[model samples]
Target: KMHRTVLALVNIFICGCFASPPNFILLFADDLGFGDLGCYGHPTSLTPNLNRLASGGLRFTDFYCTSPVCSPSRASLLTGRYQTRSGIYPGVLYPGSIGGLPLNETTIAEVLKPMGYATAAVGKWHLGVGPKGMYLPTNQGFDQYLGIPYSHDMGPCRNLTCFPPDIKCFGLCDVGVVTVPLMHNDVIKQQPVNFLDLERAYSDFSTNFITTSVKKKQPFFLYYPSHHTHYPQYAGPGAAGRSLRGPFGDSLFEFDTTVGNLLATLEQTGVINNTLIFFTSDNGPELMRMSRGGNSGLLKCGKGTTYEGGMREPAIAFWPGTIKPGVTHELASTLDILPTFAKLAGATLPRVQLDGVDLTGLLVNRGKSQREEMIFYPTDPSEMYGLFALRLGKYKAHFYTRGATHSGTTPDKDCPVFAVLKAHDPPLIFDLEADPSENYPLPLVGRPDLQKLLDRIMKVKAQFEASMVFGESQINKGTSPELEPCCNPSCSPKPSCCHC
Candidate 1:
C-alpha cells in the first residue's frame, strides 16, 4: 500500500510538472491593411491594444499572406499550403459554389485536436457551405464554429434593385442579399443579423470559450477571423461615423476593441502567459476603397495584385516567455503558421505535400530569416494578372502576360497576350530592398546572371503549377491523397532556409 501511495504521488507530481501546452489564439482581421494598426504605422489609428501587443511581442516587418484575396488566404493559412493545391484558387465562394477546402486536406485544428487540444473557430468561414462536403466547420476539424459562411457583404442586398444597397439597412439578408445567416457548426443559429453585432458577439463567444477551456484545464486553439474592415464596412451599433476616416476607420477601431477584449479575457482567466496569440490580416487593403483602408507604406499595389501591398501584411506573434519582443524583418508567410503551430503543440502533421516551411525557429530565434525565396501567384484570371512572381534575395521578378489586368480597374484595356519565351523579363525585375515600393524597375542593361535567376524562378514556378494541376486532377478524380507526415515520401522535402 505504501509503495502504491508513493507511486500515486509520483504520478501526480509528474502530471503537475508536465503542464499542458500553451493555448493558441489566432486573431485574423479581414481587409485590414498593414498600416491600419498603430504598431505597423497609422497616424490617426487608435490601436492601443494592438500597440501594446507590439511592445510586448515579436512584430514581423516582411510578412506576406498566402494570397491577395480573402478565401484563398484563409485556405492557405488553415492548410499551411497554397490554396491552389486545395482547389481554392479564386475569389471567395458563394452559396452555390462547389469548391471549398477539400475533405482530404488536413487542417491545423484536426491535427491538434487528437493531441488533446480543444479546437474552436469563432469568426468568418468563407471556405464553403450547403449540401457540399465542404460547408461545415465541424467537417473541417473545428470542434466549435460560430460565424458567417463567407464575408458579411456576400449576402443579398437589403433592396434587390438597389445597386450596392446599404447591407446593414436590411441587416443580414438571407434572400436577395448576399450575406447569410450566422452559422454554429452545421446549423444556422441566427438569421440575417447585422454583421457588426455578429462580430462583437463572436468576440464575446470566443472569450467565453477561452475562459471555459482554461477552467477545464484544456489547451485550446481559437481561430477568431473577424469580419472587420471588410467591404461594405459596418461598425457596431453605437459606432456609426465614429471615426474621421469613414466607415473603414470606424470598423478598425471596433476591431481593435474586440482584440482588447480578448486580451483582457486572457488576463482575467490567468491564461495570458500560457497562451500564444498570433495576429495578422487576410491580405492587403482593398484598393477599390483605398481611402477606407491604409497603405502598406511604401509597398506598391493593393489587394488583387501580386505587389507587396496585396501580399505583405502586419504580422505579430505574442507568447510571454516564448517569443521575444521587437521587430523581425524576416520574410515569413501565412503558410508557415500551420507547421509552426503543430510544432508548438507537439502535433504530428500528415505526410502530405505542402509549400510552407515551418517558421518556428524564426519566431523563437530573433536573428533568423524563415525563407530566402518565395513565389507569389495570382490564381484569379480576371485581371490578366501575373502567373507568378519570384522573390529571390532582394530581386523580385514578375512573370506574366504583361497586358492582363486580371480584373484590375485600369484605364489601359488592351495589351500584349504574348507569353515570355524565357522566364527572364528585362522589364520585370525590381530590387525590392532598394525599391520596396517597386517604384523603379531595375534597368537590365547587361545583367545575364540576374536573367538566369529569373529563369530558375520560372522553372520552379512551372513545377509548382504542375503540382497544382495534378492536385486538382486528383481532387476531381476523388483520389485526393490524405496529407502524410513531413518525412513521408508523399510529402515534399522541406525548403532550404536563408538565415539572413
Candidate 2:
C-alpha cells in the first residue's frame, strides 16, 4: 500500500501535477538553424550557455517548428494550433499589417494568466501590428511587451530600396537604410533601435522581469524571442567581430552569453530549480544572408522550404530538479509548448481543438511522445495551397516539390521548380530516420506495400483539409494598400498606418 501510494504521487509529478506551479521561460531564437549550436554539432557558432542548458536538461533531436517561417510558427507555438487553423496561415505578418492571429484563438499567455502567472513578451513579435495595435502582444495576453514589433530587416536598408509602396513587395533590406523602432508595451521606446546592444537590452528586460516575479512570489512566463541570426545580423555588445564564423557567429556568441546572464539571474533569485526554460528557434536559417545566415549542418535546405532543415529545429528543455538530463528523438514541436505549459500550470485546455500534443509525458521520461505524425505546410502560399508534407514515424511524403534554392533572387516564386506540381503518381517519400538530409527519395518501383503509405498520407491530408473548416484566414494579396507600414514611410502618416 505504501509502494502504491508512492507510485501514485510519482505519476502525478511526472504528469506535471505539481503542488506549486513552476515558472516558464521560453527562449526563442530567430532564424537559428538545426546545426548552429555547439550541442547540435556546429563546428563554430559558440553557444556555451545553450550547451550548458542541454547538458543539464533534455535535448530534442526530432523537434520541429510548425512552419518554415516566423509568424505562422509563432502562432502555432502560442496557440497549440496549426497556423493555418489559427488564421495567420500561409504567410507572415508584416509591420502595419492589419490581420493577425485571430482574436478568438487562446494563447499560452492567456492560459497562464488565469493561473496567476505574470506574463511578458520580449523580442520580435511578427504576429501582427495594426492601426489600433490589434495584434500586438499586449492585446493578445501578455502583461507587458518590450521589443521590436517585427524582424529587424523590415525597415529601409541602404543596399536595396526598402521604402513604402515598393518595399512591401521586396522583403530584402539592410540595417542602415531604415530604423526599426524598439517598443515598450504599445508605444515606441527607441525609434530605430540601436542594434549593437539589442541582445543585452532584451536579456536585461527578461532578467528584470524574472527578478520582479520572484519578489512578488508570482509565477511568470517570459517569451524571449531573439532578433539575432536573422538577416542584417548585428553583433551584440562585447561580442562584435568576435567569431571565427564572422558576424553571424559573433551575434550567436553574444546571444548565448545573454542566455547565461538570464540563467544567472534565475539562479541568484533562487528560482533556477523551480523554473522551466525552453531554448529553440522560430525556424531555420535565412540562407539568403549567406555567411550572415545560420548553418543547417547535415540537414538539407534552410529556411522557407518544407525540407527537414527548415522545419526541424534544435530544441532544449531545462528544469533542474524536474526533467532528467538526457536526449530524446521524440516528435515534438513549438505547437506542443502551449499544451505542455497548460498541463504544467494546472490550467485547462482551450475550448477549440489543437494540433499539438502535451509533452509532459516525454519531458519526464514517463512514456513515448503523444504525437505520432506531423503535417508540413509550405512557407510560400502563392504557388499552391495543396502542397503539403506528412511525417509519419520515420517516413515523410511530400505531395509536391519546390525549387531547391530558397535563397535565390526571387525567393517567393515557385521558380525553377514547377509553379504547379506535376502529377506525382507515387509522391516523394523519404525515410527520415535513415535519410535526415532528405537527399534521396525512395523509389516505388517494386513495392506494392508503398500503396499503404500513400493511403495513410492521403488520410492525413484529408484530415488537415477538414481541420481548416475552423480557420478564419487573415492572409492578404500582399500587404494591404491601406495597411502598409507607416513609421518609415518616405509617405506621410495615414489613419490606417500602424504605429505611425
Candidate 3:
C-alpha cells in the first residue's frame, strides 16, 4: 500500500511539472529611443527582427518608463513601483556605491518562483551590485544570473578595438578606475568584460537557459537587458557597417540580429507558441551624446529630463496565437509589467502598494490597458529628485522641466527650443494625442476645457505627492573604491590589476 501511494504521488508531481505554463521573455534594451527602430519610422536604424516581431504581435505606441534614467527606470520595471518607492532614485549606481535593491522588495522572479517557474536574468542588471553582489539578481529571486552587474561604461577591461578597426575604445586607459566585471551568480566570471562580444555572449547564454527549461518541461522567465547602443558602441566581429546611422546604428543593427537569434532559438526549441516575448527600452536615448545617443523620434528631449522623449519607449509584445497582431496607442508604463506577469502566470502578487496595473487585457484580448495615469520621476540632483511630470489619458503636464537645455551641459542642436530648468506656474500641458512632439502647449486663453483638464491633473499630482511614501535613497548611499568589483584584487596598477 505504501509503494502504491508513493507511485501515485510521483505521477501527480510529474503531471503537474509538465502542465506547461506559458514562458516569458523580456528583452530590455539599454537606452533605445522611441524612433530608433525602423518600424517606428527611423529611415536608417533598420531593425528588421523587431519589425517582424511587431508585425506578428502587439506594438505599443504610447508606452513609457517610470523614470528617464537607468537605475530608477529598471527599479520600476522589476517591482512595478516608482523608483522613489524602490530607493533607486536620484541617479544611477556606480561600482563603488554601497546601496542596492532592497532585499525586502519582491521582484517578478520571486513572484513566479513559487508557481514553479524557472528564471534567469541576463545582460545589464543596474539594479544593484552592493556588498559583494548581495544585491544581485540571484538574491532578488532569479534562479541564475550571468551578466554585468552595472552599466557597461562604468568600468575598465573593455577592449581597446571593436569589430571595425577604424573605431577605437577611447578613454579606456582612464576608465581603469572601475572595472566592468562580468558575473555569473555571485562569482565574478571576468573583470573588464569584452564589450564587443557581450551581445553574442548574452544571446548564447539566454538560448542555453531556454533550452534547459524546455527540456525540463518547466516554464521560464528570461529577462535579457542588453548593453548595446549605449555609450562607446562596439559591435561584435562582422556586425559592424550594417546601418546607415553611424557607430550607434551599427551597434543597434547588431542588437536587432541578436533578437533574431533568440527568435530562431524559440522556433528551434518548439516553444515559440508558448513563449511571450516583450521588447522595450529601459529609458529614452541619451541625447547628451548627440548623434551617437539615438533620436527620440517625434518626442521632445531625450534622457535625463522630464519630456515625452525622455520617458517614452518603443514597446513590442509577441506571443504567437495568444496575442493578436496589431498596434495599440494605449498608455502603458514599465510599472505594469509585474502585475501583468502575475496574471499571466496565475501567480499571486506580494502584499504591497503597486504602481503598475495588469496589462494582460491589453496584450491577449486586445482590450484597453488598465493603467490610466503615470507619474514621471526626476533624474537630476537629490534636490530635484521629486516628481517631474504627469500623464493622464491623452494629456501630459510637466511640473518641473530640466536637463540638456542648460547650455554648457551638452549642446543638442536637435532640440531647437532650449528651455532651462524652472517650475511652471500653470504647468506646461500638452495633448499628446494631438501633439506627440509636445511642441505645442494648449493655450488657455479661449479654452475652458483646458483649465479643467489641468486642474484635474494637478489634483491627482497633489494627491500622489501627499500620499506617496519613499524608501531609503540607496542610489545616494555614497561610493568607495573598495566597493568596486575585482576579479584579481592582488594585481598592480600597470593594466594587470583586477584582470583574471
Whose lDDT is greatest here? 3
TM-score of each: 0.82, 0.88, 0.91
Model 3 pairs in collision? 157-192
Q: Which lDDT tens digits does candidate 1 get at residues 26-129?
A: 98988777777878777877677888889999998888887778888888899988776677765665554545677888888988898788889987888766
Better candidate number, 1 or 2, judged by TM-score: 2
Candidate 3: where are CA atoms >4 Å away?
Answer: 1-19, 156-159, 164-166, 170-176, 381-385, 405-419, 493-496
| Predictions in order: lDDT | 0.69, 0.78, 0.81
* Candidate scoring better on lDDT of 1 and 2: 2
Ranking by TM-score: 3, 2, 1
Per-residue lDDT tens digits for candidate 3, residues 1-500, read 99655544543342233235678899899888898999889998778999999999999999998877888888888998887777886788887789988999889999999978999999889987777778999999999999988887886534556555545664453364656778989898876677677778888899999999999989899998888878767797757887889788889988888899889999999989888899899888877677778878888778777688888999999988788899999999888999888877777888998888988777877888888888887775343335778999999887777665311134344332355567877888889999998878888788999988988998998888876788889977887777787877656663357777
lDDT of 2 at 245: 89
Give Cα distance to truth, residue 60, candidate 2, Å: 0.9
Candidate 1 at residue 91, lDDT?
61
Model 3 reaches what TM-score against the true structure?
0.91
Error of 1 at 430 (Å): 1.2
Q: How many residue pairs clash per model?
A: 25, 2, 1
Best by TM-score: 3
lDDT of 2 by residue, 1-500 (tens): 99656644654575445546789999899999888998999787778899999999999999999888899899999999877777776667776566887778899999999879999999998988776677789988999999988887877644332221222212346322235678889877665566765777888888999999999999999998888778766664477666788777877888888899999999999988888999899988877666767877778767777878788999999999789999998898898999998877778799988888999888876469988888788775432455567898888998766643444433345432334554455678999888998878888878777778778878877776765653666766245544433454444443223333
- The residue pairs that clash in candidate 2, if any, are 156-177, 156-178
